[model samples]
Target chain A: MKYATMRIISGAGERTLATITEVRSIAALFLHALHGCFRPSRALSASFFAQISRQILYTGVEAMGLVGIIAFFCGVTIVLQSMTTMPQFGVTEYFGNILVVAVVREMGPFFTSLVVIGRSGAALAAHIGTMRVNKEIDALEVMGIDPVHFVVVPALAGMTLSMICLNCYFDMIAIVGGLVIANVTVQVPFGIFLGKVLDALSWIDIVLSSSKGLVFGAVIAVVSCWYGMAVNNIRAVPQAAIRAVVGSMTVTIILNIVATVGFYAR
Target chain B: MPVKLEIDGIFWSAGVFPLLRGISLTVERGEIMVIGGRSGCGKSILLEICAGLKRPERGRIVWDDIDIATMSRNELLTARQRIGYVFQQYALIANYSIFENIALPLRSRGDLAEKEIDVRVHTVMEEVALFNVEKHFPESLSNGQLRAAALARALVTDPEMLFLDEPVSGLDPQTASGIRAVLHARQRRRERTIVTICHDLYLWASRPHRVAVLEGGKLVEPEENHAFRQMVEARR
Candidate 1:
């Protein structure tokens, strides 16, 4: 009994240490990538910027349609549900407040991040994992190319920018969907709905949403790239992709909860 | 003679099995050192350690008197720029075309204009006899072409020290001879220090190089081997 208890305790301790080590590694990689992005002395070459632009094109521009559809449906469902249910409580005037709280402050960044993680995060991890397996990363290092500066920085910058933009776009489209649904179902005046939304929205909501987007983007980029770089063989490529997706989603959701609680906690 | 590269008291292991044990060597400037070992030996790992690619369990890798193990990350990267390495697997970036792969090091240096890079890449390509494959990706190239392309990339920078891992292991005589000629020409032009891992020791008979065979987790002069002596006698 004593030996078994010691073994379990040791295993738990080992796992904790491993998790801490992994987190430290991710933080170091993130800081290095951030330094590369902002350092003018290491001014991004035209080619490097082109890489960043390509990442944005894939992660942001290409994701617009899916985000639009999801956001619209989400907004319609929430508004319809509110219209039907809130009248019982005589809280109809709070529709705009509900919409602002749910769509802008929370759902916009969270759902968009999920989409990005599903679409780009997995792909980034697989791409980088394949590069690692093929010794391409070693080749770059042998040629004196810092893989962090070359691969991670552009990805980090691009993903962060994409998340910010996509989050904003998602918010707008969902709000539009809400307006359309409200007008069509209950004949709510467009001006009145718009005024209510505007009245309830504040700069803090916008800042919080954008902040979530930025943090989630960095989380996905760092996590995906970290898993990818950790890959050692071809068999690990798909595993890396799966781990990246899971890791990105886990971290993003955790950050989402923390951000929400930190700002809104009473 | 001044030492250009030194490996001192190197030790490495994979899992529970130790691979290299207390291996040490010194290569003088402008000299070629060939490391030979059978399959599964730690020759490539030793070369990688010497090139600062993989850290050994216990060792000092000094390049031009600067201990690589002690250098900062950026310092090590900058130091690596003066060294070139050709992997046994011909590790060309799959997403890049042959021209782009050859031009990557130069582009990363951010020193030369595109035209100069173009000229240099083309020149090295010609030296390696890789023609009409500039736009081809690694997946599209044949084995010989891939090897030559890898060699071209390593040589394009004109690094002071070259580390080649099985540079000519799986090449036809023509391709292998062409590669040898390119290395010879480079050596003739400038006395670049080279360290190579080759399984076939017979290939080095025609060239002036020092051979060290890795066996039992240690390096020994090839002259002490019976097979080497028989090969030498047969040649005579």
Candidate 2:
């Protein structure tokens, strides 16, 4: 019995090692393809212009109104709730810092990733998955064009740039809307609220927020493309899209936690 | 134009099923070789091996004295540029305009100027009679148009050898015949070395200078059109 158990354990260990090696190799291939896609010298000016046009249409223009409404209401609600509670401790002055940290560093990246994942990530996965099912990827291979370079790179570049821009937009709207709410609803002077915002804001905070957004964008792009490529049939497209969004959101939140700890610890 | 493809004892498997077992074949320049078999007979696998997409477990694919199985990825890519592949599904990039789809391979070469690419693309599109539909997307195209667009893209680079995977399947009889006619015309015009996979024995009989029948993971004999058809019918 002891020898049999030992053999079984050894077999399982070998299987685990093989799985790990396969996963590592696939990860390395994905990273290499991503690197090729993002290399600046490979960017054709015409293709870049075309990608910018698509990004504006898909990410920026399509997402602006929804993000604007969400940010505005989020700011107002946070301020209203904070005012009701902070007066007990007379730490109402800390409201600006709380709002900035919560909204800018945490909520901003998280919400934007969620929105983009729902909108662009699903679309990207479905598009690419359909292309894969149709053998367009094989066609690219036959033509000697690396599908990663031609299809995936533009998407990563566009989404990363767009996510950063959206976060900035969200940040601007939320802070301004919070100031308005504090002035109108809480009877705080507009000048005092503005002064608090300016004082509480730091370059480090902006960098952290932008970094979070960048990571979220990368996660969404990579997960979407990975799932898209894995899809083999037409029926698998919707499931791949759903997986991309859910996977991106989950990774985004986890990464946010890690980033927050690292940023504050620094 | 003297392109030679020699596959020597190629062995392939999909997770130990052994799709192609020690398959060896050769196609000389200016010859049309039709790989005919029922579905799942590994004709596509053989074509993929020749295209360098599937590496044989233990064999060499030599193209004009160079073993493609041993080439570096970039070298394999360069070698692939000299071969045209028409996928069964007419794999035109959906998001791109037909012009852009044809232009994709040209852009990858990174050696051609934009002007040269445009000229080559236009010439090939004209050859395939797809010039008028260049602005349309693949999603908007009819089945015949899609196949033509795919063919135009395949032929754009003027590959020395062309591989067609079920080029006439899933089309109306009239449309399939028309595509076969176009393929025959193109072959005659260029005398290109072409390897096509098809189940339609009638179409295969009409065009191929040689026919290879794959059955049960083994390539059967005759390596000629008439004798191969006789063998196929006798088996049936």
Candidate 2 lDDT score at position B67: 94
lDDT by residue for model 1 (B13-131), tens: 98889999999999989888888877897998998899899999998999888899999888888888888889989989887799999999998888888899999999999999999
Tell me the tens digit of each residue's lDDT in model 2 across A1-266.
99999999999999999767744643664586568655732424466558656965797678999888888887887888888998898877788888888788888888888889999999888888988888888787778767776667777778888899999899888888898999898688888998888788899889988998887887787778877887888999999999888877777888888998888798
- Encode model 2's per-residue lDDT on B1-236: one tens digit a residue: 74788899988887879888888899988788988876887888799888888788989999999998678876876778898999888888777899988887777777788999999999877766564887999888888789888888888877789999988788888767767777777778888889899886656675688877787677775444454567568767
The candidate scoring highest on TM-score is 1
Fnat of all models, as shown:
0.70, 0.60
- Considering just chain B, what TM-score does every model have? 0.96, 0.88
Once fitted onto the true fold, the runs of candidate 2 whose alpha carbons sit more than 4 angstroms away are A1-30, A37-45, B170-178, B222-236
Candidate 1 C-alpha lDDT tens digits along A1-266: 99999999999999999999999999999998899888722423765888889999999999999999999998899899999999999888988989999999999999999999999999999999988988999999998898888899889999999999999999999999999999999999989999999999999999999999999999999999999999998999999999999989999988999998999785
Give the CAPRI rating of model 1. Answer: medium
Worst 10 residues of 2 chain A by lDDT: A40-49
lDDT of 1 at A198: 91
Candidate 2: the clashing residue pairs are none
